[model samples]
Target chain A: MQTLHNGKLTRSVSLEDRGWSLGEALFETLLVQQGNPVWLEEHLARLARGCERLQFDFPERALRDDIHQLLSESRDDRAVLRLCLSGDSLGVRGYGAVSRTPHRYCQLAALAPPVRQYWDEGIRAFVAKTRLPEQVELAGIKHSNRLPHVLARAERKARDFPEGLMLSASGLVVEGIASNCFIAVNGELKTPLLDRAGVEGIVRQKVIEVLRTQGVTISEARLTLSDIEAADELFFCNSLIGLWPARQLDCLSFSSFSLCQRVQKELESVWYV
Target chain B: MQTLHNGKLTRSVSLEDRGWSLGEALFETLLVQQGNPVWLEEHLARLARGCERLQFDFPERALRDDIHQLLSESRDDRAVLRLCLSGDSLGVRGYGAVSRTPHRYCQLAALAPPVRQYWDEGIRAFVAKTRLPEQVELAGIKHSNRLPHVLARAERKARDFPEGLMLSASGLVVEGIASNCFIAVNGELKTPLLDRAGVEGIVRQKVIEVLRTQGVTISEARLTLSDIEAADELFFCNSLIGLWPARQLDCLSFSSFSLCQRVQKELESVWYV
Candidate 1:
């Protein structure tokens, strides 16, 4: 495994050594094809927004160089790359110390590509009891505070399901445990609005954009389980998986995956940049 | 710096190395005095509950032994010890992998005691714009998803304040940036209910317990900024800082620290266990 830190390659780097708790960091996982990243600018833009929201100074140029170096040195035609930006130490200084200087240590690592079966035949998902809180301040930012997703994934596994559907605190169907969800109802695409909860997934926006460009109106509205049950098709999308049609959600089976397949085809056409 | 991993001494351990993200971890900080940990059982109980909620197999005996080892090898009569339990990776198996064997990489580190001046003289606090989301599943658990606190602390620093009061998503006063909050109103002690938001701090519980034992009434209810502004006294309590009286919250001043002082004195009588 090759790792790049602040534009430099290094094998020995400790994220925990500098009090860089994962929750205090922001990260973006991207799929690379032919030594190039899909939607690199959009991912970095979201990272910068997360840094601003969490008060970390985003070293944009350095991180871009790091990504460039990682891509240039890597030979994997298809793989997963994770760019992690860890911030300053939240020491015992909260006692009386008034301030802290934010530090940036960006690390990028390449990992195995996501499984292909999920995108091929779709996946089974269950509604999780774990809900995303309605913290508007941190909502939509992909900071590393992902306990809700972790618990939701655990809940899905406990129920013997493949993936899980996360709900907002208000019980609205928000997104998948790690992927954004979209459903077709009355021939219109509908996905949950992430203003109150869930990450503003890069692939989700790309899907919406491609659909709109093809003259398909997509509604970014609050979606409920009942809404999903009546939907014509269902699918999950992420930067890594691209798109996985939800073959079954609990007892509700969504076998009509034509729309999902079209979207996935469009996604793959450009996802491997 | 000495590091203890799962009750054994280790000089090197990377939390991210094993795919363990900090948000998937649970931690509790305690003040150690003469080799004894303050609120040992309480902290462990909270950690266990957090483990249960996050699906981590709580290695109770090993953790207890780790605390013992860390405290024994340390020479500081008065110091702070942090017990961190980070769990296994949420592997890229976001596709279909159903289960994961829980890993227990508990790290214990000795940190410097909190600065004393904030405790002696009340610290200044400002209400933070960053609100705690109402995620009932993770409301009171000290899971490491603490980006809200980090951002709130930075907001406080930018505003030139020592501490910040966090409000819930519904505009209710929840707690301090790192501590639980309490206020006096008409000779009664009032604090926010942790069932919906905020951490269930050990020191805050101790304060309530001691005050109730002394026949002082304490109410754990929802509080708002208006309620705080009309209060007689305000204070913050945490396991690390014990308690720090709030001299000023924005423009409202609290000069009478009698109740806060009484609670502080009672807290000190047993906090150095």
Candidate 2:
């Protein structure tokens, strides 16, 4: 458990951690802007929901303290903070956790190069060969079972592209390699519903909130490749990269990003220092 | 990779291991009987194949050395050796691996109370509420993305059942919580196909090999709940447990495990010391 400790935190994890064995854990990637973790409440709340789905208790106090401790020691104003909560170490057997107690870890790293370039100029995208399988129980949570995402990212790197859209086995578009995607077609904004597959990204939620307040109609739907292909504009969103408009996907190209630009401008303070 | 190291091994794992954060790893659970790992070659070969799919090179020599070291230090004659090969620690980013190197870890735990009881008297099972998603890319390998399996096991525990059967989104029977399922109906022994989901369990493979040699007809097919319900016999298999016939599943009961006993007798040496 994320027990409150006045002592030092260990940097290493136990070898028997189920998070390392079965991906039986939940994680959140938060942006630390100027020594402050942005949207701390939202990230921790999402982590709590994920912990509930994974049957692990939310170590709220320990996690908050861990984040505070990491940020205090970090010199970088703008950094990336990752919090991982997994089953605590115990003598192992099969998949069952010997003790229900869990381990909490927080590590800080440097942020990627300026995310604004992608937001302004947009980024090229491709449809990844990796498919997102529909598992309703695990849907919408940012758990650690992310091999599919890793495969898609590797595919994107090999193809020399920055991002890619993943589709279900039935050819329904789901999400991006590491972000959630949205498309505007016929002046209606739509994002893939993560009720069946994909993560309900925090930035995507914020973008929806901001746009809905601005009188823009946004809805979650089961999107297909044809839907995005016929779209007037496309963009991707995540906690780190606020809004990255898609200029091209495969051979198709887009020249419009009005909604994308609006969302980016509105959330600039939240994602950046 | 599994590089040959002549020095002592580290007992702790890096917190940044993708295996812990993203479940980007492959593991093998080998049954060590009398200071020797059973089916060692087969397990390593499966690990190698899993490495191929995950885009990581297999550390064959290093894994062997780790197994030897753990086994040498172990006092339990019959033990469970877990080999976890995960991506080496690196600076965090998206899902891409900065360095292609991987970390291999081997730990030994005392075997559970003699598995002979479950094999002799059989066990009760229930159909799990958790569904195994159709992940053809990840199918048939013991990769660490096993939240589904863990959930199923937990459901079994909650229901007070010894085991549970996992099904796909379309209600097709796939596998057991931690093993493979086989059923005999009208003299035909059939197992669920792993083409779209489920692990191609090592013991399930061995059972097929031994059964086919004895002229028993065994087929891998797309099975349904109706199929198992109409079966004359049913059993589960895995490396550590060998063969465990199912006496009952939920309300349905089986009257015979004749074919199961035959297979058990044929492979006794492989499973037991």
Candidate 3:
């Protein structure tokens, strides 16, 4: 696949790059529909915040130029864009040497077929054993140190589940493998507070915004497995697939999704662009 | 600095590499003295176990060949070698696609001058606000997702402390920025139990084995700041810097180090080799 590395057309970076060695980086995955990113500014805002947390300067101009240069020549909808930024190298094993010079690597690829299928038919999710650590230092940012997600996603695939849910190390349900989880509890949407862990997904914010605009209440609550068990409806949302209404969580099948359907409908307007 | 990429001489890897994008990798830092790596097999064993936890196939042959190719022609007594291995590129943003094809990058550089100084003059330590997340999934393995260490180290630097001590989110002291901590209490050495967080360092294992062989007691225990405050002596140990007897922690001064000196002397024979 063709890639834009620091606004240049190449697929190679320095082997000493911090992203490779230390994971001193953050990334944002977005959906590009008809040559335009659906929520470009919102994703950038989150990315900028991550850069701030990591003491990295956002390479905004270079990144935007790369996006524009690529999109100007293509009109493909359902394309996935992954923008990664980090402060260059680890400075030769000096843990204190956090570079301020940012490196931007962006790739545009076709959205995987399973994403569309999962979005349509919902997905079967099992709670994974890989627990998210309570690291407020890296919370709410889509940083690149994603071994927990990788392990959890693998666990789900091993069990033949399309998606997996993860809990904090203390066992509070936090999020899905790649999405923010939302539950309709007593007709109000409640998601786990991301004060301690989990990525604060932009699509989750969009869902909350759309629902709130429609006078539907949504709040962040410390959720557990029992809270999920007693929920009237369940769903997952992310930037790429937009929303996946849960049809089955373990053995407790979700045969009905009135709120989930409404969420998908509301998201379709912006997701489809 | 000379570099080896997958047993060949090169200084670049694919930008698509999972090590760059997702930090799906593990690395070991060793002191190469007089054409031989200190504790090569021991470090490899720890790396292999980490590979197992990450569901990675340790690329033993390629890595061994790379080390042999790189080290054969050099006889630098005080050199630093960083060996990195990762299953290659994230396959097209498919989180489920875990590539088993390993990418090995090795860098051999002259040991930085500060290492020797730090080894001589004991360092001042500070309690870091960046707590280690209590995720047992990642505990004990030196995987590349090191944002916690990065942040804590930065915090320590900002406060002008040479080394930083991190606690678990639940307020239990875990480990140092790059070292495993040991404290002496009533003539026995105790370290923080790493079941919840922190990297189980190689030198830490070596120190324990040496101290045990010397008939000195060393055990893992859940440590707190109060425990550190009450310690008779304090020290840090890692692969590169064998041991640093801490002189001050926050504002607490440590003047006597009977147990610390004994442990350091036991490790010196092995470390100075």
Candidate 4:
């Protein structure tokens, strides 16, 4: 695998670099198709917002060059491009004199095996026993403190499922292990509000936008597992997978995916394509 | 700056090492005084517990040998030793087969400047706007998801205070940015319970034990800011500081240091001697 760090392309990184242990990092994963990254601006915008939230200035212009260079050198026509921005704790020597500067790294690798099967045949997902804390300081920003996701993924794997749903402290469904969620309930498309918990994924935002622009009513609100069970259809989305329909979540199952299909078509055809 | 990685003394490490960005890491800080580390066993026990919680094996024996060797080579009579164990996400290929393994790294640094002034003159602290999530899975583990502390420390610095207090989502006082809290209410010692939030600091544990053994009456309870304001005295403790009394938090103020001095003297003479 090829990796780019602070504008320099390298194959490896140092374990001693503060990023690994401190969890002072943020990342964006963009889908690369035909040598181009889909929704590059959205990804960068989120990255910038994350940096601002963490009080670091992002060098988007420099990072854009770094991304293009990495993509240009890659032989794969399509892949997953991961851009990681890590900060240093040097200024933490004492109170009053601290600096929080972040460096950027990019890694290009083979596209993950298509979860197209999940999109077509549907998938099994369940509500995880774990809960997300409603941290306004970290809500929506993709900083690297992802122990919840790591644990949730482990829980999903233990249950013999491909995805798991996370809930907030008050029992509201937040999002999936790695994907954002949407459910069509009572003829209205709904997803969880990320103001208190969950990541604001690029593809999730795009889907909400494109659907709303196409005259579909969408609402971002706090949802529950029962809310999902009441939905006409359900789907999960991220930059890499586009969209995958959930066939089963606990005892609830849906065979009619008309709304999911329509949203998926619009996602791929209008926005991502 | 000498660092020991996996029992081998090295000056630096590579970035490809998995511990940096994944937040798959645990760390312990030991106070080295007169060629002896205070509470070595307790620190290692916490490290072991953190490993178990994260589903990684702790190489306790190897780490013990590494600590001794590093101490033998050190010239400083008093210093701080930071042992960081970072886990790898090597098995996380795409979605299904990510393996997590941890590597250990140790860094020896000069001891932080004593906050005895805070003990002598007392210090100023405030409740941080940022809140800790009530994560049962990661409640007390010292695993390396510390962006909250970084941000809190920054907040404290910006507000021109020596330390900041962190609360849980439900408005319960959890801890300081880097210390455990203790308050004297109705002449009884009270600190926040770590079962649902906050770190289980080694010094905090020792303080509770010593205070109880000395018949000072300490309770671990869910406390609010109002509870703190109602207190007759306030203080903070960690491995590094031992204990420092707070003179003011927001609008509250206190001049008495008799209880804090007694605890501090007992702490240094009994456990840390």
Each model's C-alpha lDDT?
A: 0.73, 0.82, 0.81, 0.77
How accurate locally is residue A145 in candidate 2, as Cα lDDT from 0 to 100? 92
Q: Which regions of candidate 2 fall more than 4 Å away from where they truly are?
A: A1-7, B1-7
Using lDDT, rank the candidates from best to worst: 2, 3, 4, 1
Question: Which model, 3 or 4, shows the larger DockQ?
Answer: 3
State the lDDT at A88 in candidate 4: 53
Query: Which window of ten consecutive residues has the lowest lDDT sum in model 3 chain A?
Result: A110-119
Taking the tens digit of each residue's C-alpha lDDT, what string does model 2 give over A95-192? 76566667777777777545567878999999999998898999999888999988878876733577899998767889998899999987778999
Q: Docking quality tier of candidate 3?
A: medium
Candidate 4 accuracy as lDDT: 0.77
TM-score of each: 0.89, 0.95, 0.95, 0.94
Evaluated on CA atoms against the true complex, candidate 4 attains a DockQ of: 0.56
What is the TM-score of chain A, computed separately for every candidate?
0.88, 0.93, 0.94, 0.92
Q: Please report, as a residue range, the 10-residue window in candidate 3 chain B with the lowest summed lDDT.
A: B112-121
What's model 1's TM-score?
0.89
- lDDT tens digits, residues A1-273, model 1? 566655555553343433334366677888777777888899989988987776567788877776777677777777667777665444433322222333334443454565577778888888888888877787798877777777776664633565688889888888988889999977788999988888999999888898888888788898888899899888988887678888888888987887777787776665434
DockQ of each: 0.43, 0.73, 0.73, 0.56
Task: Summarize candidate 4's per-residue lDDT along A1-273 as a digit string, tens digits.
Answer: 678877887655544344665677888888888778888999999999998987878888888999889888887767888888887545243223244556778888877546557777888888888788778888998877777777666665733677888898888888988889999876679999999888999888887887888788999997887888789888888888778788888788877677678777766543244
- TM-score of the first chain in candidate 2 relative to the native first chain: 0.93
